[model samples]
Target: MSLDLPDLRTDLETLAEAHGITGAVVAFAAGDEVAEAATGVLNSRTGHPATTGSLFQIGSVAKAWTATLVMQLVDEGRLDLDQSAQSVLPGLALPDPVTIRQLLAHTGGFEGDVFVDTGRGDDAIEKLVALLGEVPRLSPPGAVWSYNNAGYVVLGRVVEVLRGVPYNQALRTHLIGPLGLTRTATSADEAILYSTAVGHAGGEPVPTWSLMRSNDPAGSSLAMTARDLLTFARAHLSDGAGVLPARLARMMREPQVTLPDLGRPSRWGLGWELQEWAGGTVVGHDGSTPGQAAVLKLVPEAGVAAVLLTNGGDPDPLVAELVAPVLSRIAGVVPPAPPTPPDPPLPFVVERYAGRYVSDVMAWEVAGDDEGRLWVTVTPLGAMAAHGGSQTFELVRLRQDTFVFAQARGGVHSAVAFLGEGERARYLHTGRLNVRRSL
Candidate 1:
């Protein structure tokens, strides 16, 4: 399959500028053939042009790497997916029922989005788990799917304890070094040694370049180039001989849970999100940090993979638009179409839906404007609330119980569903489910 690399580069550059992105890198792999392109500047402040080798924070996409490491331990008989996290890290305070597999699958049913800075010390993950002692369990283990950040941190602790080393060292010795991913680093300190992209928020460069040390395993700590990311994806597409057995790699892509709120792929595997598109099964993960967004995707049947790493602006839409054409033209994989609202749209009683919903980390106050339109004011609670503050957006009704919010930043649309009917509705579901609080 011949690819017009120059044409693809031009298209990517145009898309990046249209999105206000500071830096962008894209890489594609088809068996032995590989192609890559970069556009914009690494940092507006530095005026450095992004190259194919420029590293960008891959965010939660690194979760698949961490999962791969955990699977390697499983391959060695050093860890059991069903083993309780508390048993592995005896000092850790997670619920005993929360198994290693649940953590990997984001089904541990615990408060998962905790992002407290545990400091720059080597014991950061340990300290971060120590802080988990006070976090309330959101649901029973293996009950439901929630994008759990804290669960991955616990998994990181599992790696450290089982490997008898820090999370960073364990990742390096077991995965990064052996896989020959020279551009990938576990923390900002090591990443600084390479040509890197500085993250940006809005149109301004981000003040901080890295996440808290504790987020290393959860993806806040790793940085890599688009080429390296696709390389990793390609390894997963084949028998991961040195890194993981082909069977285990295949296991990681098996559907573990259904993600109803997330329309695409709508199901998750061990670490990969399973998107059963019309073309084929494209397994991958996306990552987002303060001012960076990254996406890594692979079409296994086609033996093809692609990755996009960006420093700033809303790269989600750009990824949606860019990856489809690349995959279709290069790998003969047709991308899924964007979801549309139901015909005639479902109607709901606005009066009953308007109320205060509360959760461990955030709160949502749903009310109506004088113009009879509904709006939700989201307030982040706890430490996250202190940092991210609050955001209010008007909700466009899509169904009797569902509405979509076009977020201010990237004009990204997110669905909000009210479970139950009228005043009997018990919860409001958005990134995570928030139970309705009493009046």
Candidate 2:
């Protein structure tokens, strides 16, 4: 694969220009040396031109690093992926039987913490646990995948308890120090002299990261530079840096669950998102903090990885625009841009499923539209757009009957499954609230 550097640079600049991004420092590596680039003003107001060394919050992309630390424990046999969360941190008393692997992959049912900055140290972990004590489990352990910030708080506590050190210190000793990442730190509160970016909400001041300084390892707040992030991604691609072994890196990159019907069909690995792009797997994580957004992606088979960081409201479209061209240039594969799907038509056989069904806990009504599409008005007004089913109520027979409801940014919030014969449908969400057709 050959890379045309000049053309790629123009594309990047064009993307940054489109996003009103005043500053962007980007780096690309392909199993060899770092090829870097920068653009715009690091501080638009003061007119500080962004440089190759400019730093930004890596956001949840920090999860890959945290997962690596957890794997270090796994390699040492101190933590078991299959063991219950209770087994690892007995004092926390999590409500489910979630295992360490689930936490890594977000398969655990632990509720996510909505409070952003609880504080950056042990107190953050304590507040998170207190909050978790009151939040109910969405599903049984391992039954479904829910991205849990609170779960990572538990992971931070586990790291602290087992290593007998602050989670930040442990991250340093295990990851940043070994990798010689001078600019990376778990604490957002630390005063680093590098050019920094601030986060905002709707162009207004929101809580800065320090507000909820977390020992949490899920990358709620880890500050780093674009070059450092590219270095981290490259290391995982070839296992060259020796920070994490190749096998452990794959474990983090391998898809543990399939999230279909997203704006795209993606997979969730251990703290990483996996997608089959071009001819291989593109493994990475995306992070968002108030005024900041970051994405770190590495295509291992193609041997290229890229990182993009921005301080503003939306970073995804801009990041995607930046990386797509680089991926084509370096991989020599012009990947197909995702095609927008047209409005889905109503099911041809929706009448058979109309009825009231009772399950162990939940109840719902299923009816047909004039277009013959299945419409489920859940007892609590859980309306879903059904794709496929039979008028005889053979929902499970239709793969399209399954529906996943996700959050604002496309994170899967809950899934509803309707599978069964006419008037005898089995409906479920996160494996809880089973809804069946009333006979």
Candidate 3:
């Protein structure tokens, strides 16, 4: 089941141009053979053609790295999964009793997307954690599954506290450097030392390529090539070989919680999203920054892993369309098609879901459209609003309580579920739980 590298390079070039992707790198690994293809330019302004080694911001895909480090500590008897997060970092203030395992599984119930710029000091993660004292708790710990970036930041601080080093240093000393990921880096400054791709928004290069420095642990600041990412994935696929212990690596991919959103993968493990594809189970993570997107997928049964790194343009469909066919052809496994909403959507009371739901990072206003269809307008709040104003989507009912919103921007879809009675609905759960403001 060897991949035809020549054919893949041509296919990637065609796909990149068709999808409006300015630059992209796709890599596939099976057994010991790895094939990579790069398409388009690293930066449109420079017109430098992208190469196999070009680095792209891998985003939240780095969370798997953070999770791996935590598991390493757990294996060394320095951290306990069931221990309360306050026990590890006593200065932190969280409303619920969150455990280390909950943080990894994204069931910590805290407002997850707290992107506070706490300066470039070594105390950035500590300062970022302190700011969470003001954020409201979304639910009781381990009660629900929401994508929690802040939780990973907390894990980063835990790593620092136990290792007696900064988060980035700990990542390098314990994981990146040890694994020989020479092209992988933790900050924009480090990434500049390599052949890095400039991110793009609306077919134009982005002014800033990285997010706040404090977000390094949560996958906001890491950059690497698709091949390097697959190298990291290969460690897990090979059951941690030289890095993590075999048992710990296996435990990380075990489904820990059922994700409420029907649109996403059905379950989440420690840091990996678990999807039961038609061919078999595929586990991986996808990431997004300003204009960059990346995805890593591993088919354990097929002994195949794939990574896609792109700067600008929607990489979601591009990765989906490419990864499936390539994996199926090379590994003899077909990745499952993403779940689509019921055609001619089911009818539900539109007024029942009409209300304003608010969270620390964003707000959602659900209202009725002209034809009585339900639509939800999401407005970024506080510091985040200046970057992206607002977006509206028509909700297609998937069930009595669940609905899906297919955003036009990236053609990406997310699920939202309503809780509480008809008129007294108190919360709308999406990436995070947004509490209803008023009727």
Candidate 4:
């Protein structure tokens, strides 16, 4: 079978221009053949031309890398997945006894988006663990599936404890250097040495480079070129083997916890996301920073992997229009399409989903009108409000206890999945779990 490459540079330029994106890179690998291309500017103000080799923030995709390192320790008999995190990291306190495995699977059942800056000192992650003592626990450990950032932060601190070094250094020594990813950067100082893309949110270059350093393990400062990212993705292909043990690499793609039905990955693996797509299994993750976004999908059966990294704007349309076709042609793998509103929304009982769902930094106030239609008013709070303001959205029921944005916001059909039983839903799952205040 022959694999041909597309005109990726032209495709990216056209898509980036149409989507209001500052810049982007697209790269993929099938067997040993690889292709990559980039378009637009690194920063609008500087007018630097984006290149295939330029690094862009890879966001939570870094979580997969952190997870890989933890597995590496496991392979060496140095760490155990089921070991309680509090066992290794002595000053750590949690409402429930969380295990390393639960943290990896994001079933630790805590408010995972805690993003307090703990300074750039070597002890930043350690200080982060100290603060986790007071964070809100969404459920008993290992009881629920919530997308967790703080859990990875704690995992990063664990890596530091075991490796006897900061997370960044451990990445280089264990993974980056071994994988030969020369373009990957773990810090702003390192990123400056390469042609790196800065984020542009709302078509304007962001004032800051990356988020707080304390959350580095949860993908705050990691940046890399699309080619470099695909290089990392290649390591996880089912048949591929090298630095990581073949057994653990295969385990990372196995489903750990099922995700809520909200047009996201269907299940969570040890460190990666697993989705059943078009009769094939796709393993990967999506990530976003202040103004950048990235996605990776690998059809393990076909031995093919693809990634799209963007500086700003929604990549949904671009991904569906461009990236999907490439995977389909080689592997017959088409990503799940964005959910659409029913011609007439299935008749919904408003009281079931209507109420205030609150998280640490965001809220959704769902209410019903006299016409028996449902709507939502989203209020971004604290640091989230600083980046974007709140807006109202009409709700369209897609399924039982699940609703989608009536109007596509950012070219993506966003959604909310209300979980638990009874008339009043106990929690709202929107990528992250937001608890119901009125429950």
- Best by lDDT, which number? 4
Superposition error at 158 for model 1 (Å): 0.4
Question: Candidate 3, residues 75-148: lDDT per residue as tens digits?
Answer: 99998999987898898888877899999999998788888899888889888988878768888899888788
- Whole-model lDDT per candidate: 0.81, 0.63, 0.85, 0.87
- Show where candidate 1 strays beyond 4 Å: 340-345, 368-372, 386-389, 406-412, 420-423
TM-score of 1: 0.93
Q: Write the per-residue lDDT of candidate 2 for residues 291-375, one digit (tens) a residue.
A: 6778887887778888887766456556556676677667654443543312353234454445675432235566665644455
Error of 3 at 203 (Å): 1.7
lDDT of 2: 0.63
Query: How do the residues 1-439 of candidate 4 rate in per-residue lDDT, one tens digit apiece?
Result: 4567657778778988998888888888898888888888899888998888899998999999999889988988989989999889877888888999999999999889888898988888888889999888788887778999999999999999999999999999988998888899999999999999989888889888899899999999999988888888888884336667788888887888898888655888899888888769888889998789999989888888898988888888778878888888888887777888899669988888889999998998989999999888899886677757778889888987778888986677788898988778989888888889973
lDDT of 1 by residue, 1-439 (tens): 5555667788899998888888898888888788888998888987999999899999999899889989999999998888888878777776546888898888887777788888899899899999887776766788777788898998888888888999889888987787788798778888889999888987779888878888888988799888778768878888676689999999998888887453344688998888877768888899987788898888888888888889988887677678768888777777665545454545556777888988777899998777777788889887666568788887767656667764434544667777654465667777576778864
For TM-score, candidate 1 versus 2, the one ahead is: 1
Q: On a 0 to 100 scale, what is the lDDT of residue 425 in model 1?
A: 63
Q: How far is 174's C-alpha from truth in model 1 (Å)?
A: 0.9
Q: Candidate 4 versus the native: TM-score?
A: 0.97
Can you give the TM-score per candidate against the true fold?
0.93, 0.77, 0.95, 0.97
List ranges where model 2 is wrong by over 4 Å.
1-3, 200-211, 332-339, 347-439
RMSD vs true structure, all candidates: 2.3, 7.2, 1.8, 1.4
**How displaced is residue 179 in candidate 2, in Å?**
0.5
Which scores better on TM-score, 2 or 4? 4
Better candidate number, 2 or 4, judged by lDDT: 4
